[model samples]
Target chain A: MTHQDRGAADGTPRLLRSGALQLETGGRLPEVSLAFRTWGRLNPDGSNAVLVLHALTGDAQVADGPEGAHGWWRGLVGPGRVIDTERYFVLAPAALGGCSGTTGPASAAPDGQAWGSRFPFITLRDMAALEARLLDLLGLASWHTVIGGSMGGARALEWAATQPERVRHCVVIASCAASTAEQIAWAQAQTAAIRLDPAFRGGDYYRHDDAPRVGLGIARRLAHLSYRAEPELESRFGRAPQGAETPLGSPDRQRRGRYAVESYLDHQAEKLVGRFDANAYLSLTEALMSHDVGRGRGGVDAALGQLDAVEFFVAAVDSDRLYLPGQSEALAAALPGKPGVEYIHSSMGHDGFLTQAEQLEPQLRARVFG
Target chain B: MTHQDRGAADGTPRLLRSGALQLETGGRLPEVSLAFRTWGRLNPDGSNAVLVLHALTGDAQVADGPEGAHGWWRGLVGPGRVIDTERYFVLAPAALGGCSGTTGPASAAPDGQAWGSRFPFITLRDMAALEARLLDLLGLASWHTVIGGSMGGARALEWAATQPERVRHCVVIASCAASTAEQIAWAQAQTAAIRLDPAFRGGDYYRHDDAPRVGLGIARRLAHLSYRAEPELESRFGRAPQGAETPLGSPDRQRRGRYAVESYLDHQAEKLVGRFDANAYLSLTEALMSHDVGRGRGGVDAALGQLDAVEFFVAAVDSDRLYLPGQSEALAAALPGKPGVEYIHSSMGHDGFLTQAEQLEPQLRARVFG
Candidate 1:
């Protein structure tokens, strides 16, 4: 294949570059390239394109990622799934501050060196802006729909508000128009977990074999707790010791054993440590912290008012403490139809947005895509 | 002042020593001494003695501790307060595994060395047993009331179940009949935070100038979040950057700045790190994790059924995410009369049990203290 055609190889990561990316804050990057993956072909009219946004710690692989690993939303988007790629061209871009094949802090700058600690400040708005540019590079004047959840939802809302004509449909699940104080607080704690680690070295540890795994582990532990409901945790793990490892013993014995829940969290942390980047986590987390759809628009109502033409389907998990149903209701109230928040019932907390696909398929089909 | 009489001095920390304190799980301490503070006088009839239990990080001083530190429950129990010290003799004992003037890991063993990493595993049952012994040394055959919240509530419930006649009335707030899986999960995360720190030195960091402050800080942060409601956090600090520290900036700026909520949590962690012992924190936390009153007594219902003779006043925080109101309702349902759960409404979560004392006063005055 020719060098130009090589970019279209199966599972190949596509990059969208810009000469100088200006941030919402005054900081600027000399060069920026966002990694992305695509499934299905764009219709000649380019009217059937669908954007798939991922949450924090998620990459561009919404469908078939390299290595054939299952994509995060694999159940919701495919040949004949809810967001059916058989009929619509689907594109999932790794976020601006993300690490997975994206031009994040781990990516080399114009100097041919990793950005390290020099990566510019990024906001949710900046990320949305960069993704908009990326979409333009793919020759897409406007997308048929923009779909995401949690942090992804934040970007989808921003896209809808920032360019009303660009997005025909917006689906936000288990997220709010802005990061609430509690959300910020949790994010702050997670960031502190990474930043306080001696191994973090102010985010310039690219050369180190270890990359603040302990800190990242702690962060993941906190985040994982938020992702699932307390009831789920209580029923699943309770105070049960891992296997035959009883907690009633000496400190040495206690140290050797773990509660089942702790072991579950440890597994989660280990999984992330094996694949994720700590600096990118910090960057995307900060970007999420900067999520405010109404920052320039007068307020949340006014911001949603800006999306007069975009069809919106906003949903909340009944058990989601992170993004309560109340926030979703508020978002729905601000939309054109003033729709009531759709409910996605699950014992899982915030993660129900991802796990309860069958329950969501009808709603996604009828309101967002059908 | 004579040595014996000195124990009765105002705010004096009374120590009751046993040759060896045997643990429920087969571990043993060479010796154990419980620290307690008393206020008012026990009437000759011994009918006016009131045992006050402190929460996880609390000390012997329920009304007043050393260095003039106010008691943790100072708002609820004092002259003219809900418990009314004027009408009853008040006693607050430092928990068995606690640090303040009590026999904990910070306390010396028979060899005149800090227990440190060698400290044996302690259960909630052990804490109750030690307190029972301490009460026996006080020459009080029985207490008119056992009042507590959180860990104190756990002890109070244990006292009522383990020795029915010794406690005439029991008040438990923002606590459950057993540590749920979610509670255990949170505790596990906290314990892992301490254990993961290399500075922990296998929990024998007593000789080090610094005691795993970073790890302890993380634990405190996580615990503190669970102790407060999301809405409260959102309203109080909602995405607000710490004063003069905008979230937008380079890595250096991001590193230097913090969200206001982070600062609040930092203050909390710093305050605890200064006074609380990490090993003791772990001990008490583990004690809390082992707090299933139903363990040997069938289940939670059968366990609470053991409190047949005790007058029970069970209450919950309306917003408590940790010890949920449902758990409290469950506790009430299993009581002798199947008493309805009383709720203390407030923006605070589990902490409402400590802060919203005024709302609890009326209920305490009539039902519990009456």
Candidate 2:
């Protein structure tokens, strides 16, 4: 498959690089390729740059494609928007351990077969390291701002902590220094579901007739609930029928009353399975589960203590269930100085960073691009 | 166990008959004798009575339980409490699917085997019907008041809607007309986890060496998160470490960190498993998932319209994640005349009905007994 076949969202030239990257799995991933898209013109000094991190299942495309829907972050990265293309050069890279034209399980192995079940375990630090290498290749030393939400937030924190001198400002929204026990528990359960799907076949389902769609759908459904608030779910689909029936004539109900919420969940599942790779989903979720800034460092507090950047903005979603607001507050408090942490209230819950960007733009601009 | 073991907490003679009460599973449950404690004493007419409801896993005892802690609802059952034990003889029957002194899976069958894998599915209607049978045995045609919290609130609601003439004043605290899609989804995941353990053996783990304790513990941990609010969990455990390594070593470490919340979950799981039966927990959790007051009655609006009670008090916990506060408000609004619904602010989430009794007392007094 040629690189052009993948197609860029906004006619931007997609850059592809191949190399060997060491993974936390104690295995070396050789001949890796990263797919990335850039917005705006890089200055002569190549210093006026901002990285736009994407959420789970998102790609480097930040604009609307010729057909289908716009990129996931279309709300925040368009012309004259928060991450405006008129000013700072924007970089949106497909994350490591992902499927969107990036080196992942779908990548070819040294033996000329698909990596499939052989991809090394990826981590947040590894993702940041890859990005840092990309920045180095572009002749840029320090980033003007590193901003992200959700797992992107984790990567942002990793960038600030692992390469402090290379990042001027770190804007982490709706995320935590580390995934909480609750988050890890959910991820673990999702991984189990994916692995148990008969079609998963130890991640070698790439050549099989059936994919682990059921497992991937289950993961997406669970994550979708965390991304949206209970109030939103109830308001949208409270005990409403799905207008469908199961083979047993039980109304095709899985979760109580055949409510429209179940239908919504089904839609999310179907969408994820249709567009995403189950292996990449599993790999990234596992990385999220292993996300502990203090894993090798003393503890979370000690690891956070190493962050000396004065320009730190921690934004929390009040209704976030996965990485609750308190986690963000704790992260903010751990910074050397008392940086002002803000709460972005939205019924969207954890996905508030993507949905309620307007309410949070002032703080984002003041703390990052300002 | 003999009849003496079934006496009231104060050593008084229990009036209700205690027997095996053959289950739908065709098993003769032993050690299933009921320990019923009544308040205000049975009247000669047997009509001046209020049937009190208890939360999930609560027992018939509603006051001081000998040397044990106060019964689950001691605050709401005294002389001047909401139910007014002084004027109305109150009866709180342990739920049919409970692990208390009720006919549950832990009870032995006629062949001297526990009904671990033999317990049939129980529904909310079935539970309310059991209470009806108990009232019938006592020669009472109807109840003056039906009061309950959480699952108890659920039972009270069922009593009012399913048997309107049998229930006059219905007081539901921190309950919903139906389990939301989220609640059902959680319950399904918990059940699936417990059943996934090989030793679970189709719920017949009583004779197995490994009782699927890990699976059950994980289930309880998940349930516990829903039971308490994010604020409560943050305030209580936050990021505090447990200061010890799990016997399972570092894999547990990778997933659970060292947070005190992990320890708290461990404690809750142990408490539930030690005092309760895993099979019964699964059965009851599934039963709760099956609880939909709107099942075959058109929908929630129509089902709630059927409640023709003399008085109605619908209450919900402000931070309840499973059953949103809006749901309780919707239920109250949908009542025949749009009765006043009470809001109880507690950080205990859905478990506020059991854990935050003080927050519920005022609402109970102002709306029920008043």
Candidate 3:
């Protein structure tokens, strides 16, 4: 097996240039590129390949990058971990329409300008199809397992449904087969926050010195709350004033200090705004909003029925409110073999899929990675 | 007893101007006026008086107004309903920091201009105190019962804690003893939305031709979702597209139509923007975020221990995600007598307090009004 440098020395994701791609929405990307990171070596026939997808705002660094840079899923993906890089060839890709070195709205078009307002709408299926092309370029016929959580889970499910023969084991966590009404509503508010920002300039703000950071920050604040459990927030910061800053007792409303929770949300928003692009956020959010495995395939049950060739392993965070555990139950019930949903007990809401992933090690080994 | 036409012929709320009033935050309203609507006649000695507090966006109209204008709580407060107006003189005052005929940011100041940016922060306790003054002017030393839901419930709880002897019975529904961390977080997003709008002008949008309606609309959309249950939304809309318009398949994101749920939220936002003031919304939201029945009076338990003279009746919407049923349970458990929480079974979520009020008629009549 050949050991190739899959990542840059500066810790940037390695880019794979591809040709024109047809989108699920009937639109086309004239040129597409995928940014990815890979660990371990592939067998000569490439049958031991495993694909790891990331959630919204997540990048290709599923495990540790060069120079011991931390990864979001480091606990579950490194050598000697549950995903054991020594045993399987693992590939983690930055999602399409994402800011992390991937081809997104911020990427330049054939005309040498950012796609910006002209970027076409893409769906989770399109993202899965794009990943499939990347795999084809690597001479891989099939994956040992396709696994993800949240938006990543949605993409993993799409892979199973879109190309059933190619995926051996399909693992989905903290996501639904289709976007629920509540999910769409929340996304609508987030996307609206970005669009309403005066600095957004109709998604063509690349040329401007200032971006819609405030609006993006607000969106992040809103999304962060939804990602967390109310009980967890209550126990962590219940109505406490941030430091000595009084949330009340101020004659001037403008001068009033924030509650601890507000301060926490502000911090989360700031962190996201500094690293993310407003247009990319909107693009990815809209794509998730359009997620529906049933679309153009009868319905969810019928779509899953076609995935008989793929073994399913579904899991849900017990306290997940964004993508309710009931959604995972429904998804599990619809799968070919009617697999029972593995529950991950957590106080972290939808984000438990990422934070509580260690709890899934045993079940993942026995049911999916085995 | 003699009856008086409290409301004007123009359907405007009746205003009662008073002398300077001290606020909880140490600020003073040089001159304050309360906009109120009274139904039925006040008996001699005024022992039959019932004070019905309005929610955040609610108004003075608790029942049918002159010429048959509908009230928000008309179903539960009518001539022969649970809160019978014929037997008990009912008064509902538009909340302070509200736009509906109340002294708020839109109200004229001593300078004959709108308060706008000059309005001081007011807490739920301040609102209850103002109503107490209103009661004093009407020759009512105490209320037979002070009943409310949501923000109104917070005010009712405050009244019981602030002036235990003045309120014979306090009925709080779908609210908590203090605003939770999650509640403050949600309110932060809402207020941020309004403040971020370009037309807001830092709460001084009264002089602008375009108010912060767009921002206000976004805030309402977010709030309305929190006001409802996820299951309710899923059952009602469930990935359905709006009439004749597709949420997907549009090459241009700008040209994409809304989902059914998005349309529903848009309708809700439009209705609120047409009737509410942006500055007033911000003021009331801030006040709610500052809500704490125990503030300056010790913790919630110690504060409730002081309300020995006020009988408590608590109720919660079983599916309320915003103010979880557990909050109502906690409030009830902390009350003087530890009243058992009355569960109003409804799938409508937090809005169940209004939409499912009829479900509380039996409990209200037997335990509260009785």
DockQ of predicted candidate 2: 0.14
Tell me how much of the true interface, by contacts, candidate 2 captures: 0.04
Compare the candidates by lDDT and give the number of the best one: 3
Question: How far out, in Å, is residue A41 in model 3?
Answer: 0.8
lDDT per model vs. reference = 0.81, 0.70, 0.88
Candidate 2 has an interface RMSD (Å) of 7.3
Residue B167's lDDT in candidate 1: 88
How do the residues B25-120 of candidate 3 rate in per-residue lDDT, one tens digit apiece? 988889888888788667776787888888888888878887789978888887788988777778888888889886888988899989998999
Model 1 spans with C-alpha error above 4 angstroms: A1-12, A17-19, A64-68, A110-113, A251-256, B1-10, B64-69, B251-256
Q: Write the per-residue lDDT of candidate 2 for residues A1-370, one digit (tens) a residue.
A: 1323322334264656758887654557777778877666566677777776766677888644445446577676766777776676778888888998878887778888877777767778878888887677666788988888888888888888888888888888888887765675456556655665668887888787899776677667667777787767666765555676321113111222344555677688899899899889977876775677776778778877877763688888888878788789888888768585788788878888777766777766776665
- In terms of DockQ, the best-performing candidate is 3
> How well is each residue in B158-254 modelled by candidate 2, as lDDT tens digits?
8887888888788887778888767765665566556655567877778767677756766776677777776666666544567764211232112
Candidate 3: chain B TM-score equals 0.96
Query: In candidate 1, what are the lDDT values of residues A1-370, reduced to their tens digit?
Result: 1325323543456776666788878778878877777777666677787888999988877876557767788888877888787777788888887788767889887788788788877887877788887566767778899989999998899889988889999988889988888887788778878876778888889988778898888888888888999888878887788888765555443454666877888899999988898989988888887788888688788888757798898989999988888999988988888867778899999999888855788888888778
Pick by TM-score: which candidate is best?
3
Q: Write the per-residue lDDT of candidate 1 for residues B1-370, one digit (tens) a residue.
A: 1225423554667776666878888788878887777777676677887888888887777775446767677788777888777777787888887898778888887788888877888887887888887556666778899988998998899888888889899998889898887888778778777776668888788778878887888789888989999888877887677899866555343554667887898899999988898899999998888888887899888878767788999999998989999999988999999878788999889999888856888888889777
